[model samples]
Target: MEVLQILHMNKGNDETSYAQNSKVQRKILSVVKPIIDEAVQKMLCSNIAPIGSMGIADLGCSSGPNTLLLISEIIDAIHATSSCSTSFTEFRVFLNDLFSNDFNTIFMSLPAFYNQLKEEKGAGFGSFFISAVPGSFYGRLFPAKSLHFVHSSSSLHWLSQVPPGLDCQAAGKALNKGKIYISKTSPQCVLEAYSLQFHKDFLLFLKSRAEEIVGGGRMVLSLIGRSSSDPSTQESCYQWELLAHALMSMVSEVNT
Candidate 1:
């Protein structure tokens, strides 16, 4: 039993790690690309020339292979937008994420991405200035009305932490008794805690982005979401469920 428990705990840790890694900020860029393009087109149509150093940001930017890919798309969108107009302004990008994120990986990749940008000229894909910002998107990470465009994906769904009011006793019993994710039969306290966290986080996201984006600036967000309005439907991605199961398995193993 002790050996089984240890194995489950290790499996859970891997599952959780896998879940976090696969949900980087870049995955949703394509989903919102059309919106970004339209926003850029509008800026051009409005004669916003010399775009005056447009500020772009990617929030909840996790460290992974996909991070740089999204940055490139954003630069392309900006230049495409700028080209339609006469804007020749230098572009500055802010890549934002939590302090604990693997910023080192992002930083190390910058020189190559920057050098490539330097090589392109007189095109939307050309030059761009980039910086990695360490912070949470839920808080004020940018200056007042400083951003012209913002992008975030697979990030907003994350609660800062697990909900506080979850009934540990209930959660423990569920795992010990061989239940999976909190089901419809789960305790209301569990569901309420999760719902409140999501609601609070969503509101914070709106307020912060609203304050940072200029009056006509654009903001794009893509995230994992529940298929139904009901929180107990358990229709989220299988990866998420696998991670949750791993967590419970780990907990039960340790107790044995």
Candidate 2:
């Protein structure tokens, strides 16, 4: 499937856009801050030899407040611990996401972002160079052993495409009817199909990232998954059922 050609979060700062709806993601970032801080500290300290530059990539780095904010946090951690370390004098930050992501919005925000970094770091932040690399993280986006730190939040739950065995459609019947994802109403096959897709995509993601990240590198990720073995568990699957009901209600109202 050409999943790479179509995956993108909603754009802009409007009510319906990802920018406005990313508070949950921001909260996840906050929860993971200490981990991030520790990772940067260790990455800096582990560099016994001068490495010239530190390469950092934020996979699924959708554009918005969290984008530059996360970068700022990482740089601060590095400075607090390794500002004087000649092992890494420069920082290369890669902001990566799908091709259709609103890179323009991120780019426009850069002028303000750069100014804020300078204001906060007092010109020492001048060492950080940022760039956009739009693509899927399910595959390799960086060269081998190039990145020292990686970060991704609220992005990996998405599969490259709809799971297999779900493509079955006849004249009128739907395999997983009246729902957008695996729900209580869905059959066992639907759950298995979805799980299989996730396993395939996630494995590929790890394999790809493994090649790009350097020795002693670290990655921080936040994704949606279930603690239970059963995929039909309400805690993991109820939200989609509710959404389906809401969507069908709207459709019924329009039709009537």
Candidate 3:
């Protein structure tokens, strides 16, 4: 719980904050733009089309330039594909993140975002209703069939809590020593616990999203992950292994 207390990006436009270090996420979104465009195009053309308004949610939307980028792209796609048969009159965009997220920063930067939108799409480019939604994405966040499109980027690695492990070497002691997550020396049980927790979390995410999205709605998820099944594999965990080595080397130097 103590760790959870401080689990948010740094506030303001600081050098060491998520706002300044999210270019990689922006590029990923650019790479997936075609996919989003196709999905939005199809959703707009669906028989149960967007009538008067459309509901869109950007889950795990950190405060920064990236906050409104997804919504902007979605709006562009819809407008580009719009005709007499399919045209939007309004948009309700939900910016979702954890309770600890830097929401104030987002609100502060919103004036610029709106101005940009207005300049690009005109003042009456479908009444844009933006709101903040604070919560974990592991459970239901919206009403049933309430969303037309949902997007999350550069998240999904964070667990809601420490995964329960049965194989404690001693009471309240972790089986994996001196490692925050799966390591080369971690027992098989540690891997199992982490995997089980991931499974449960992913299942919960799907169940919750299912209740919120209509049949033809679309969801895009971007996460930093590996393709390997083995947690200790080099390609899967070299970053952590290198970090552990660097930290241990520093400690050894200090001890000596």
TM-scores for all candidates: the values are 0.77, 0.91, 0.88
Predicted structure 2, TM vs. truth: 0.91
Q: Give the per-residue lDDT digits (tens) of candidate 2, residues 1-256.
A: 3877876778998899888888998998888888899887876777544457888899888988898888988888877885545567788999999898899999999999888888977885447789999888988899998898999988888888888667687456778877889898887888888889989999999999999888788888888767998878899888888998999999999999
Better TM-score candidate (1, 2): 2
Name the top lDDT candidate.
Answer: 2
- Model 1 Cα lDDT, one tens digit per residue, 1-256: 2211121101111445432456443445666778777776776566543447778888876665567777777666666665464554666788887665666666787887777776764344434677888766766888888887788877776676656544255535632133333455556766676778788878988898889887777777777766677756747434556776788889989999
> What is the RMSD, in Å, between candidate 2 and the native fold over all Cα?
2.3
Candidate lDDT values, in order: 0.66, 0.84, 0.82
After superposition, the stretches of candidate 2 with alpha carbons farther than 4 Å from their true spots are: 48-50, 169-172, 249-256
Backbone-clash count (model 1): 1
Report the C-alpha lDDT of model 3 over 1-256, residue by residue, as the tens digit. Answer: 6434567877678898888998998898899899888888777777655536788999889888788788889888977777632456878899998888999988987888889888998886577889999888889899988898998888788776778763356556759766667878888988888889889998999899999997778888878777877788878667877787788789889999
Counting clashing residue pairs in each candidate, in order, gives 1, 0, 0
What's the lDDT for residue 248 in model 2?
Answer: 95
